[model samples]
Target chain A: MTRWGMVIDLGRCIGCQACTVACKVENQSPVDAWYAPVVEYEVGRYPDAQMAYLPMLCNHCTDAPCIKACPSGALHRRDDGIVIADEEICIGARACMTACPYGALHLHEGRSGELLGDGTRNTPSILERYAHERHIEGTVSKCTYCAHRIDFGTEHGLTPGIDPEATPACVVTCPTECRVFGDLDDPDSPVSRYVVEHGPTGVLRPDARTGATTAYVGLP
Target chain B: MSAPVSALPQNVFMDRWALEPKTQRVWGVNHAGWFTLMGIGGGVFLLGRIFDITLEAGRVLGLPIVDVVSFVTIAIGGLILIADLGRPLQAWRAFRNVRVSIISWGAWADLVFLTFGGLLMLPDLTFGDSTPFSGLGWDSHATSGIGRVMLVLASIAAVVVMVYAGAVLARPRSIPYWHSVAIPIQFLASSLAMAMATLMLIVVLDGGDVTRSELLATAGLTAVLLVTIVVHLSTRTTAPGKKESIERLTRGSLRGTFLYAAVGAGTVLPIVLGLLALGFDGGAREVLAVLTLPLLVVGGFLLRLDTLRAGIYPPVVSLLEAAQR
Candidate 1:
């Protein structure tokens, strides 16, 4: 019954990519593939220019289209409400990724197809990264909401099995505290309370009707 | 929806239509090419079993070595499939979204089953003696439980392989002509159709006597093709302007293939051959069925080839023009 949600305060946001780097390193995702990306856009005429950055990731829709489209049953929503994928069961089908309107997923490559030898095609320094782990050329991956860490959060003394003390890497790394996470079902939770405080002017891409659990508050 | 000059404009010929000799020749060759490759895989498996046959007891046909054959055949089939795709590197992009795309899901389904099938066939491939003769890959000892577990998993994947090919191509949204849910049914129908046809053709060409089972297979395949056509016609849906587009094939360029190969030789002729044997004894009827199997197989291939060729992408340009109007 507990649906987790996030409240992102755009007013206090800065476009610094610390959150992106944190997510990448924490997830150990390849440099080319980003679990979270900040999309930059410019608005208004040149005389009165303004720039904005929107950090995009899985919206984790209630009626997730990705789940319904997966033929292999690799992607499934867990009892705790997190959508997870069984990599072994996945057939490298990209249907779920395309079904996502928000462009949330990416295919995870397997170790089977990685290049064997150090290359002179790129600088020796650039070759070091490739020497680390052999890339597997055919699997899909995305944010798991740091579920492993969150599940063990109580050991860090924030809360016992209820709310994990270690926030999502992106949220934890945000200097501005722009991203807030908590249970939407709990009226006392910070995210739920923030949404109740802010009005309709707050949400992003509401028309997509994903019933996005994450919210963008106080955006002009 | 003005008629295009490329098409004949009607279903005038009915059952008289046959596959263009060009396509007929090409299809036969194409199918044979694929079958030959599968035979190589099957041959490897048979070799594995023969090595074990002297050591084991009863049946010649049900030897677990068949798993090796099944694995090689499926892998060869997989290769043919990848080669057929217009883009292979971009093929990985198919997995970009599993939730909404049928092709992506189909790709996944095919891979899982294919991998499982390969794993089941592996002990033979490796020629490892740690296992024993049983079911394809099943009779082996469990020196390592992982292989046994994989065999179970592979069996499930084998079924998926059969089902996915049909389901994926039969996608409702992506390919307009392939829209019917009956497509997978058609696909299964066609695999049998082709299998029997090829078997009969090889027997005939090689001047070998045919078996009763092969004849029955032909007859059964003909019935399947007939049922598939009915199912296809009944289950199909068309967009508002698509009727005109579909008309290109129904009455135009594609009409010949659909009418002759798919309907006549593929469906009707095979049915007639089956019926002609109704009054005859098993030997004669069986002979007739074997003779007709190749034609039914041709029809099944036409269904896939013609449908693939005839399917149109949205007449986006025309639609855009109309919208502007």
Candidate 2:
């Protein structure tokens, strides 16, 4: 009955990349791995130059192509509408990487375990100790919408979108409060209300027919 | 009072209209190469088996070259596929999910094809006879019947293995170039063309006469390959991203590979050489056949590589541009 989604208000986003840093810290991802990245591009010519930023992450589509493409069934969708990849079962065929039009999925090449030229390692000891769920070598990884935080918050009688503790790190860290996360199916939810108020929100590659859950307002 | 400068609307719109660069493909030349070999090998064995059954051909000379090529290439392809995996050890899990995954079906099909193809070739290797159980003094008729059954099963599996390679790539809705219905059909036609070319080469080398039927088959398959390429290129895509991908193949960065290697050398050159071989005689014909075969084979591989390379992800900015349009 629950379909989790995100609404990004491009008009309000300053594109400081605070959310990107917060996501990396919260997830303890590898130096090369980015769970959320802000894609910045120059819009105009010299006299009228402008920069536009688009934050990219997994859309977690209702009809996920990655789930169908995974030969090992390592990628699956939960009942709550979150799509996840099981690292243990992943054979690293990179099928899902090709299947995703958004370019959200990434392969973790185990660079985190590599020794540096001076015999020092790049991955922090704290990350090694606490980020056990971080992707291992030869496995595919992607954003999970911070399901762990949501589940934990729900168990503790807190609402995910309303409570900072229950929300995704990127959503919580956004300075402009541009990111909205809530159940799309619930008419009363903030995400659904935002969509209704804004009148029109665009999903990436709607032509892909993947039924992307993430929507954006004022994308241009 | 001084005022802050801001970006113009036209500049913002232009930025939103710009197409993003192509994403890095996970399936690259290695995957393309192995899949092509597998399709060619499986197709040759299946067609050769069918020919032997219908034409009453016997095991001539010593080696069953067609069977050997079939089993070897498929085996090697299967190995390469496993090695290409990030976690090669977990490849066995491919069989766990067959309902939705073309890759899972491909793995199972490869297994069946190899097993049955190997079984069909057993009597030839062991007893030097066309019939299984002949060394044991069993009824030759019964052994032949069993061989036919095995050949039929192997051929079915071989066809599936060949098509499944294309199916796996085609099923991804993301890449418009590979998502077309023509892709699998094109792959199947190219596989058969490669198989026929290989067969022609082997026959010519072995001093066996290149039969007219085989030449016709090769020509027909080459024609199919050409038509499919045209269809694949001409087909209109609904999305701007897909249209951009098509442009990349027809006129953009991938044009050299698509036009020169895949279309020119692979399809057109082979067809010309095949036709010229039919016109020539003696050593001249053999030379033409030999030259023609490798071109077709290489072309097949290049076609796959071009398709893989041309797979452009849907542009993120296209969503914004669509509203303006």
Candidate 3:
């Protein structure tokens, strides 16, 4: 009964984009397909203006619209409440893209955008950096909550949020540790504790009622 | 909160952020193209059942002329859908989630419409008047009981194809403008009007007699379509006020396309022309049908394209809302 969830303390995020770099390195997403990126906006105007960073990713909702809107049955939520796409059979109709209120879904462009003819060169070039990406081309991609690390850690008797090995690449790489990932079902989990202490709201577009598992501690 | 006309609306704090509304790039002109083709094809096919206009028309390559047009148009639309897909080879997998997904439902409907509709026309192409059905005292394949059953099935499928295009857009709750029940009704009205107008033009150009009944139906449908568009545009302005989808369509960059082409040329122009034609008889009506019909078809396409292009995902952060906060 593990409902995996995340809580982001918006105040703690410094807009450094370490999570973006870590996600790219870990997931090897194509140039256009940013799995996790910090979106910043202005709070005030002119003389009183201030930049506000909001780390955005897949909320991994309880009643996920992307899963329901997927015409190819490519998107599915696991028993643990982690919504992952089966890229093997994705037809890439992009119905899920329109359905997601948060704009979480992204199409994985096949090309890695390396320098042309870099693959033919012998020296350490951009080709070496993107030669072995595991992502399937022309499939819809999103933040998977680092299911790979979580699965391995759980099997090895390690707690996800507490252990760096089990944690998501973005969560672990975060300099301020603003993002917290844990099982929502566990009453003693960090996410649940944060929910109790700060009462992080479910999602930005609450009217849609996606039942988003991810919550924000201080939504601007 | 007025709609920001420019792509970038002076977000000084962050260079790249969702400050103003953003148009959804996923389903744009490509989707509009496919939907328009399929919807018109289905609408024309369905309209033939209501009136004997298509049945009275001569055959092309041993198949009813309407059937040939419907089949080819739908097939071309199918090609467009495949072309839009990222993985075109695996397009068959689109039917894997028909239960929950409206897009899947549309795909299934398209299949049924093609299969049953194609089968209904097969005998005419194969054996003509002296086929197996002719031996059973039926002059044509369309005169048989099974043929009538197939027609019923195909018509149902065609109706679904016409409606499901709008339903697919409306299913995405993310886009506030599209998230409405009126969209499907408006689409049905618009498609039917365009379909009827196209049929009349074809009949007129081919030196066939123009009927008043056909003209009236087209006019009625066009009027309904106009009402739906007006009502839909005004009512859908509730989400986040100025930077909403409706605002983008009505007052933003898409204003010319929506107000002029879709509303003026597509709906109002046709209705006015239809009235002028209906007032007179003989050659004048035929000429008006010729003039108005093309406008309806092109306007229909523009209407769909503008509406689709106007789908603005509500601004992530509004300066006005932030100021109020």
Candidate 4:
């Protein structure tokens, strides 16, 4: 009966992209596909211009449009409220890609095996990377709320939001402590408490009726 | 709407605040080809069956030419669909979840149409129900009951194949321009028109007679397609990317493809030519039919192509507007 979610405090976000790098390092997503990139935009005219950052990731809605759009039943939700795309069943129709209001899902086309541009040799070769459930070719992927870590943590008697070993890499790596992660169903959880404290926390594409788990404070 | 600072390919994420629409890169020429072929195949099958069911005038002694065309196009379209997939080998997995997924519905529809459609054509063929049957069984090929039922099943599947191609696109709310009930109906109209035109050409080439109702069906479907185009053009909804979609089709980058090719040449020209051909008979009428049918058929393909290319996703910023709402 758990619903994992996150609440982002935009007021506290410094736009340093620490969480972005953390997500990339942890997830090792395909090339040009950032699972948790903080997209920055400028506000106001030149005289009062300032950068505003929006950290983008899968909202993991209760009524996920991607899951509904998928013809192959590749995308599914776990009992603990995590959305996952199973590589074995995925036919790569890309319908979920179009159905998603927020461009959270990414198509992995075996870019992990290829060498990076400019001969940087930054990332490890595909063979050297973690083989199990890492990157699957010709399948859609998105943020899984680090369910692997959560399951591991739960088995070992650790709290998700409080324990760095259990939480998502992005939440753990944020220097400003802008990202809060916990079970949304539990009122005592950090995420629920944060949302309760900050009344009217905003969600992206509320009109989509996605019942978005990710909420934001100081949206402007 | 805030103005963009850089002129990127619209789809690329940039430092823009405004909710500009970006063209979807998911479906391309391959998908367009798939949609076009499926529509044509389904249309031809449905039109031919209408004659069989309603007027009881469908060919029984020989393989119905229209059904063959339908089978071929659907086969080709199915291949194209597989080719268009990221994982082509696993394309069979797409047939699951027909209840919830429109794509699955389409896959099942195509499969059913192919299976039952091919089977239904067998008993009607001169050699189909004989040699192999006589050798295997005592040549009593009188399975009295299922002809009409099979025909109805195949016909329904054919209709789904034609309509679901549009429903697949229409089901996506990410693009407001395509998220309309009008799209499937328009596709249905366009598919039948294209099929009718193709049938007309076949009749002309084979020296078979052209029926008046066929021409009337063609004209009626074409008229419906024309009205749908007008509806598409006049859709100035405030649904994020709708304005940009309209602009793209009307006066923007996609204008040449949408306006000139899909509309002017494919749609309007055929109507004008068909109207003029009504004034003639004999060889003149035949020549006019030949010219007009090709346009209608080609127009059908272009309509699918241009529409697929015109699918613009409201820029990433559009989410903020929805968030605000």
Candidate 5:
């Protein structure tokens, strides 16, 4: 059982929003919607202050708070520790968002179709931008770790599926090679080795027992 | 206002109409007045507690004035809700399904928050010679336990409170606005905002106020407002009905509620006040803090009230109009 995790090196990060754009395109998220967001914090005062960007998405904790908070089991943490949302079953409660300390989850509007006055011939607009694909509202969304791509790591079994293409879009597109994604369980994995070489700070809510898989290392 | 003691006509339809509706018959006092008083009292108690927690961190032994007041306010609010109920004992019946009922969770959360408050006060009452607790008499262990329990229960109650508020307005099908994932976020955000506002109002009315907490209150209010805005903005792609409701909130007659209350007062005002206070002399900061407190509270109240009033109750509104036609 491979547990997936990502190591973000704040030292190498340049505060560019490439990861944000990459995650959006890879996930086909709405133009205005955010799956991976880069939040910039200005530290120190005036001239001494430098911008520190934290690119965030679902940490996919082993014991996810979002999953526990959802009254409707719309959010599920997969066996691989990738938290996924089932849009159809979601009641749009948004308890998950409140529970998420990182503020990674976003509530996407669910649309079945527009009901005409006569209640027929529904007009669809989700495809208006995407050209054919339709995404609904009333559903919460977050980074899914691109499970489909990771699942088919190879077209015909190339290199044991080890971090080859298993890295998330955000991880792959990081300009300064700040983000690292691989199986946390594999000691030789880049993410695992990075964590071992330089101890990283895991996400901690006030409760501090959520057990976040994603770690932020060498935050400047 | 008192109802006129007019005699009912003997005709069945006329007599039925003549009898005053249960809602309209004055309970000897004004309904709006009672609601206002209740709101004010509860608001004050809530604010006091928040100030105590934010400023002092609740580190010292014994109950803070805010904690005692908050517990009392909660109990009073619970009683009001029960009084409004048709079958008050059925309140217990609500607990039968804690899994599904937000109301049930709210009741339990209230119980937990209050119980913790009371238990903390117990050691003080035992006549221990501790400084803060010496007034009453709680032991150090008892105080710690009480604090820990209160902290956990308060966090849980916070969510339960929002859930109960949102559940009242939520309908998955119709009024698209209420159907969005932002329902709980809005409710939770508004509750915290109101809680902060209520605290500020009480501080304004009371003497010997702690000014340092004004900063913390502003910070808390600002954080919730930012989150609320994020949630509200995310609803643009919601169902047409919901989108229309959001339009009403942002651009229509209901825009005042969103603009003045949620945005201007709740968000911008608090941030500006906090920042302004940082630059001012003590005297000016004190005055500005006093001024901004009410604005924040009013903002919170207007936010909740507007959201409640503007909520589309769906087929009820349409069906009633159709029936009249």
Candidate 6:
């Protein structure tokens, strides 16, 4: 079975936030929402002051708390260890929001469109074509690891990590190539090879025991 | 041990993905209020059953007042909860995932309680001794049997409702302050205390004598509330996230609420009043009981609010920084 995972190399990340923009455009998330947000923080001080950027997203854990907390089973883990939310089934209870330690899940309140004054836009943007059917007011949403692309890629006999078209928007758009997407189960996969070479990859909130799939290299 | 380094400073060595510490506002006053109201409703029903079993004081104003309170509050609470939902229309989905979701179980429990509690009160509200469905051979004796069954079922459901509120919060691994065994116990104690106070108020208002035993029980439960709070605060966990949450509660921004509302007003004041009621007699005792009841109610609500507010997300930067240091 394929356990989809990601490896983000912090040393290679330039804090450019191009990945964030790509993810937002790909997901067509609300103006306020960013599926992958590059959180920038200052490190060091005085003349040695430097800025660090950390792009945050859903970890898609094996034992996801959001799945357990969802009263309606709106959030569930796929066979391949990808955690996805069924927007239609979500009752907006926000239990998953509290359950997620990563602060990845978000609720849509039907905010005004970026270009329009009445919380809407005259033209249907590119994201509208691939928008989830239940993407309406008062539903919880989160990153799906671009499941549509992955599924389509698999059907077309293309590799997810190696094929540019099959990969996640963030990974494809990352100028510094800091983001890597692949199957953790496959030892020869880029993510696995990267982990083996760089060694001692870090998962966020390991103590949370959610069995996070997203690993980090050169985190600190 | 090396001096504990604070994670608040901007220039800190931490994980690249470390997020700034922020309290989640996913569940606000609506969630807290629903839990508070439901806890009281369920607690009242459970206490009423104890009263029926022991004191045979089930009827108030020629009706089961506790049953009435349960019916009203649970119904209102259920509605409030539904209204709080993003898709209120799809709330029926909450009933599907019963095995894993406490929310599903809670919905089912509330429905059961409401059904039985409503049936129990129907006889009094309707034709009294004369059976409304005599043609169906449903007599007063049969109705009494149904009421008895309702009483048992409602009581069980009531207990579930009380525990469910805390259990839902406890299930989340993120907020360590909430994910504790002590949270449910504290909620249970607070629920019972609030119920007893409400019952005392009702009895006093109805010109009934406030029993010394009831006052003592309230006091005991108040003590339980205090002890549970202390235990919840003091219990050590290996999770540093939990430790940071504890700090936020005891000495951080939420300290005023914890000190004044939850501990002082919610626990201590009620205990003092219960004690005074136990010592005093006649109208003075009744007055004290009345005063104690609202204090407990407000305190209970504040306690829920305090718990909600004190819940701090595990500081990603802090944990990573500590590991590096």
lDDT of each model, Cα atoms only? 0.52, 0.77, 0.78, 0.76, 0.54, 0.77
Top DockQ model: 3
For model 6, the docking class works out as acceptable
Error of 1 at B85 (Å): 17
The digit string of per-residue lDDT tens for model 4 on A1-220 reads 7889999998788899999888877877666466788877666656666677788788888888888889899988898888998878898888988787777788765544333333333464553355323767677777888888899899899999889899999999999898999998899998888888875688776656787788888775
Look at candidate 4 and tell me the lDDT of residue B84. Answer: 72
Which residue runs of candidate 2 sit more than 4 Å off their true CA positions? A44-49, A113-133, B1-19, B53-63, B127-149, B237-239, B242-247, B250-253, B319-325
Global lDDT for candidate 1? 0.52
Where does model 5 exceed 4 Å of error?
A1-220, B1-63, B125-147, B162-164, B167-174, B194-217, B230-234, B313-325
Instruction: Evaluate candidate 5 by giving its C-alpha RMSD to the native, one decimal.
Output: 20.5
How well does candidate 1 reproduce the true complex, by DockQ? 0.04
Better of 2 and 3 by TM-score: 3
Taking the tens digit of each residue's C-alpha lDDT, what string does model 4 give over B1-325? 3333221211233223324466776777888788888888988878765644212333434556767788889999999998878788999888887768889988999889898787766645566555332222211122344656667778899899999978988876777788888788878888888887777777776675566566667777888899988987687556667777888888898888788988899888877766666777767766776786778767888888888877877765544543443
- Better candidate by TM-score, 1 or 3: 3
Candidate 2: residue A102 lDDT (0-100): 78
**TM-score of every prediction relative to native:** 0.46, 0.87, 0.91, 0.89, 0.43, 0.88
Q: Which candidate is the best by lDDT?
A: 3
Alpha carbon deviation, residue B277, candidate 4 (Å) = 2.7
lDDT of 6 by residue, B152-238 (tens): 787788899988989998987788788888888888899899988888877776668788888998899989999989887888754
Per-residue lDDT for B283 in model 4? 75
| Chain A: TM-score in each model | 0.81, 0.90, 0.89, 0.89, 0.83, 0.90
| lDDT minimum window of 10 residues, candidate 4 chain A | A112-121
| DockQ in order | 0.04, 0.35, 0.41, 0.39, 0.01, 0.35
Q: Which ten residues in a row have the lowest lDDT in candidate 3 chain A?
A: A115-124
Task: Give the runs in model 6 whose Cα sits over 4 Å from its true position.
Answer: A45-48, A113-134, B1-18, B53-62, B127-149, B237-248, B319-325
Task: List ranges where model 4 is wrong by over 4 Å.
Answer: A112-134, B1-20, B52-62, B124-144, B318-325
B21-43 in candidate 2: lDDT tens per residue? Answer: 45344677888888798889988
